[model samples]
Target: MPKKWFQNWFNSPYYHILYQQRNNAEAEFFIDNLCEYLKPSAEANLLDIACGRGRHSIYLNKKGYDITGIDLSIASIQYAKQFENSHLHFYVHDMRYLFYVNYFDIALNLFTSFGYFDTDYEHVKALKNFQKALKPDGLLVLDYFNSNKVLNMLCPQMIKTVSGVDFNIHKKIENDKIIKTIEFEDQNKPYIFKEEVKAFSMGDFKLFFEQSGFEISHCFGNYNLEEFDPANSDRLIFICKKAL
Candidate 1:
């Protein structure tokens, strides 16, 4: 059977090449603010879900936390392992399955990592896994795009050239989901990829979390930790705590 879209696309070398500009600075800022706000113990166990290249995991580990990063892309995990130390680790994992039970003090699903599943149940299962992996008082920081603002700012088509590869990107909203079709050519070989993310609103997320044993403690609009504005915010950052 063919691999899933994310498995194939995210594992490809071109994926990293196209998104190479995502670096540590912005992530560091977010992490710094998040850590300050949550104030987890200095030796808290942190889990970074769908941790592409373990960037956030490595950063938190350097801040004296024990961090574990997991992603579905094996290649990304291998590269991320190069930065591992006694307090940092990376593994290839799927978010819908359970890993460590009641093991982490904090679980992070950053950079809009959720909402890739085709079925709504799958997304819930992923959140259940996140909840199951955390301790009783564990915190979950989910950084996702503001669906309302994104829908308002949707672009139909665009083109980007990265490392001499011209990527033709087209986006559309269908069936309550935002889909991006990516086509590119490299060295005379053609490539095609697709990314489909559910445009989940805050209400939708609240429902999901409530059903998955979590309660929303805070909602921020962006990396600066500002208040959320449904009409204008660029991102929807949710801070959730495991419910009793």
Candidate 2:
């Protein structure tokens, strides 16, 4: 059997090189705003799902929270392990499987991380796993691109040169999925990878949450915590709580 696109591409060293320019400042700003709004207890336990490089976990740990970062990429987890301490830890784990049961005060699936699975059933299963990880009434913060806005403003093709590698990218929506094809040549070798994410809308997520035993507490349009506007928001951020 072939490996999933994410399992292959995300573990590749080239993936880090291509995305090396991801803005730390922006991430920090968003985290700060989220903390201000959520105001979790100082000793709260945080679970960062698909925590690439453990950036968010490390910052949250610094803020006096007990943080656990988990990702499927072994390389990413290895790099993140260097920052581990009594309050912070990293593990290579799949979101489709259960981790801790009723252990965390908050669970976060950030940065458009929820839509990669091939089936709605799988996505819902992942959400249930997240739900299981949290204590009763525990919070879950899920951040994803606003599919409506993104499909409306889809760019068909582009070339991005990062670290001297020219990545030729093509994107399209097919079969209710957003597909991105990336191609690049490095060290005289050609490589290609595809990323497919379900173009889930507010309605779709509502159903997922309902099935996963969660109730939506708040919906934000952006990292600033503005009210969600389906047609205008750049992001779809959902704050949910375990349902009684």
Candidate 3:
């Protein structure tokens, strides 16, 4: 069987290099707003599922929470582990499997991390894993793209030069998935990568959360926690709770 696009693209060094300039301020602001809105206890135990490089986990730890960050990429975990302390931990683990049962006050699947699977069952399985990892009534914050808005404003192609590397990117929606193809060169070698994410709508997420034994507590449009408008918002942020 061929390797999954995510496994190949995400584990590549060029992936990090291409996205190295992602907006950190916006991410930090979102984290701050989320924490303020949720108001977990000062010492609450948190889990960051699919936590690439542990940036959000480290920030949460700095805010006095005990955080465990897990990702499928071994390289990412190894790099993230360098920031580990008594209150923060990093592990290489797949999201479809439960890491701990009834163990966390909060579980976060941020930055559109939940929809890479090829099948609906796989997506549901990952959600169940997240639900099982949380205590009864524990919170889950799932940050994903607003598929409707994204499709309306999709940019088909672009070229970016970052740190002396030129990246050519193409995007399209096909078979209900948003596909991004990236091509670049490094050290005189040509490389290509593809990312495919399901264009899941709000109704789809509602059904998934219900089937996974979670109750949607809140939904937001953007980092500032604005009301969600399917046609206008840039984000689909759901705050759910494990069913009691």
| Alpha-carbon deviation at 227 in model 2, angstroms | 1.1
Predicted candidate 3 versus true structure: per-residue lDDT over 150-239, tens digit per residue: 899999999999989999999999889999999988889999999999999999999999999999989999999999999899899999
Pairs clashing in candidate 1? none
Tell me the TM-score of model 2.
0.98
lDDT of 1 by residue, 1-244 (tens): 8787899989999888888888789999999999889998987999999999988998898889999999999999999999998889999999989999999999999999989988889988999999999999999999999999999999999999988889999999999989999999888989999898999999999999998999999999999999999999999999999999
Q: Which pairs of residues collide in candidate 3?
A: none
The count of backbone overlaps in candidate 2 is 0
| lDDT score for residue 174 of model 2 | 96
Which sections of candidate 3 miss by over 4 Å?
Answer: none
RMSD of each: 0.8, 0.8, 1.0
Worst 10 residues of 2 by lDDT: 21-30
- What C-alpha lDDT values do all the predictions have? 0.93, 0.93, 0.92
* Model 1 root mean square deviation, Cα atoms: 0.8
Using lDDT as the yardstick, the better of models 1 and 3 is: 1
TM-score of each prediction = 0.98, 0.98, 0.97
